[model samples]
Target chain A: MTEVTEPAIETVTIDVVLSALADPVRLTFVRALDAAGDWTCGSDVLRETGVTIGKSTLSHHIKVLRDAGLIRTRVDGIRRLVTLRYDEVEQRFPGLLAMLREHGPARARGISSPYTSG
Target chain B: MTEVTEPAIETVTIDVVLSALADPVRLTFVRALDAAGDWTCGSDVLRETGVTIGKSTLSHHIKVLRDAGLIRTRVDGIRRLVTLRYDEVEQRFPGLLAMLREHGPARARGISSPYTSG
Candidate 1:
């Protein structure tokens, strides 16, 4: 099995992060992960996010998010787990996640996440 | 003179907005407009924003922003005045501008605009 590694926090650029979130499907996926709290099983992302993209496409989106350092993935036996790298991202871009969560249409859909003033 | 109109606010999508903000040069330009507060002259944008892109490319970026409903432009004699569609964007995405301007790398570089907590 190939090793699963996330990009270093310092390597994550704002442009890359924004680009990753620029897709509606990816944005929705991030919101679902955000709503998941600690971590979410990889399979649940599509169901929770309601993204219509197929499994292959979803895997691609997940790769983009992970490459941008927006998320972390852990390999647990056959099942993989994913979680938002909220603290690292917030530290790098400051209030970005909160801003999107608070105001971007992400929060208004499935998850009524508490307001986070950026 | 062709009538210059920005895309309607309702038509603006977050994906487009994020994609518009994804480019480093364009993000810098938006930051300059944010610092300018109101109606920055087009010529001043390149100078003020320090975007090194050629004129044609800058125009393209401006068009993308306009199409995304992130900005507005007005024709004044030979000069075109461009301004951030702050209120409309705020109503649409809320805290997005503030996120970039407030904590984004935009403010840390040159203009130290008053901190806005998104």
Candidate 2:
């Protein structure tokens, strides 16, 4: 399969960021990047999710996140290092990350419970 | 125009929430709701954005946000009260809002600066 060229940097928008994050797989990837704090290859990042994903799909998801400006990637030798662009995204959408922190499981008083629909 | 029925509650997905927030107008609305901490009519909410928006368009956007579980709305008499579902969204997407808060302009040392491309 041919790899699609990444989107132009100029076209990055909030929609792209939200769309990229809408996926559970992609969200997991981002959380891992947040935890790793450095460039991580796709395989290493997906380990925590316990899901087996195809390489192409993973690449696509990364591209989406990159396009949304949620993550930044650099080519180091033959490996691409991915890091969360927390600062950039937070700048664009204020009050978003703080809200997430308040609800983070790590800070929760008990086992992180799923949200209830009332 | 005919109103589309709201999406099934079960079908409400993170993608929908992200997609709703991807828009500038919608984000502004959520911010206002966060500030207000109560239900607000669409017309009142759009005033802060300084954009002239149609009712149908606003309805559509609200539906998107509601479906994403980022917001909860209740009918108060004939008016719909819209409030940010900060807890629910934060629960599902941990560390997101906290990150946003760190970047929020209100907390910024200076005028909230738009994100710069690097």
Candidate 3:
């Protein structure tokens, strides 16, 4: 059996991560990942959101997030599976995710309807 | 006795906050505020960091962070005293601070040397 190659871990600054999250599209992507505790693909993410966006733009957003270390991807056959690196971000930023969760109007009250109402 | 005017509350999205934090200067500002635990003026902050910057640029950076609701200011005599509104951010973005703290490389280990070492 061939050995599976582990993806190289790249160091990203908090500023970069925050910058990646600055875009509305990226924020929505993060929220969706948080809501759905499973790996997702770019096409599926965009389709689920129903947001009209060009392929290049979507690709750009995903790339930004990936570079910031907020999301991790793995090759699954012919598909790329994406998941949030909550542990890594938590280890790097400390209190940032808690602040997001606290400030998240919908999730704060145990309600997950922020997207629909926000 | 006259009543001091309370600063108007402004609504800011997480994306805005993250955008403001994307800047290296702004991130330094936030980290300084976290370290100081008190209201600080723009001049003092700039001086403390010893980072050479023009007045206009510094003003612009401050405005960006203020617009994002990460910091609040009150006019104290002729000086503006600025403080981080951690509580407000916490209320709005639950789990964000915790995440930041957790991920903070230095702070996570119960150390306050992130600035010097990072």
Candidate 4:
């Protein structure tokens, strides 16, 4: 479909992607999205990610991820949906997203697990 | 050796580390420090990284990286020396530092190689 095009992935840098995933709340969003298949709605994202960030902050977070090309969004009816550009990301910097998925939150909280409080 | 104590790696979080690296200037500093082994003087760091960030800004970047526990600093006579806490970091989060060393700068500038312009 000519309605959408995947970014070349080359235009996206690891810094932006990494920084996008660097935040605790954003990582939560990424994790929730990762567990979700393709095309999750904004409301679902909020519910699944369990983020309490204000509406504007949520909007900002979405913008940061979109601006970094880490995700692409589309409108369906009255809802905006998002999906990860993991394939393009993997091509851009191999193992980047996978590492983030597996280790990002553990690393971010400064501990591998909640029970292992630092 | 009662002069300084290394931070317990467990206290460091990946968010701080990732965000610290998410900056271009700081990544350059990290790259320079990674290559520098155990001890590089502050002057050598600025010279080696070729960063034009002013004194206080440089201090701030160093603090960001240091606070993240990615590096350690010590005073030697008239100069302060900086070193990567690679072993500690590796233990805290495996493959994290190595990946950063190999792919950090390339990802930050949004290009893997300077020769390949975006």
Interface RMSD (Å), every candidate? 3.4, 6.9, 4.2, 2.7
Superposition error at B101 for model 3 (Å):
6.1
- Residue B101 lDDT, candidate 4, scale 0-100: 66
The positional error of residue B90 in candidate 1, measured at the CA in angstroms, is: 2.9
Q: What is the full ranking by TM-score, best candidate first?
A: 4, 1, 3, 2
Scored by TM against the true chain B, the candidates give 0.86, 0.68, 0.73, 0.79
lDDT of 1 by residue, A1-118 (tens): 6577998887776768888888888887787677666677756767654556677887888899999899998887777888999888877777667666654562355454322211
- Model 1 iRMSD vs. native: 3.4
Model 2 residue-pair collision total:
18
lDDT for each residue of candidate 1 in B18-52, tens digit (9 for 90 to 100): 88998887888887788778887755677654557
Sort the predicted structures by lDDT, highest score first.
1, 4, 3, 2
lDDT of 4 by residue, B1-118 (tens): 5254545787777667788888878877877777666687755677555568788888788778888888888889866788888888777767666666656465344333332121
Classified by CAPRI criteria, candidate 4 counts as acceptable
CA lDDT of B64 in candidate 2? 76
TM-score of each: 0.72, 0.52, 0.70, 0.75
Model 1 docking grade: acceptable
Q: Which regions in candidate 3 have their CA more than 4 angstroms from the true location?
A: A1-12, A90-118, B1-10, B94-118
The DockQ-based CAPRI class assigned to model 2 is incorrect
- Ranking by DockQ, best first? 3, 1, 4, 2
Which has the higher lDDT value, candidate number 1 or candidate number 4?
A: 1
Instruction: Quote the positional error of residue A43 for candidate 1 in Å.
Output: 3.7
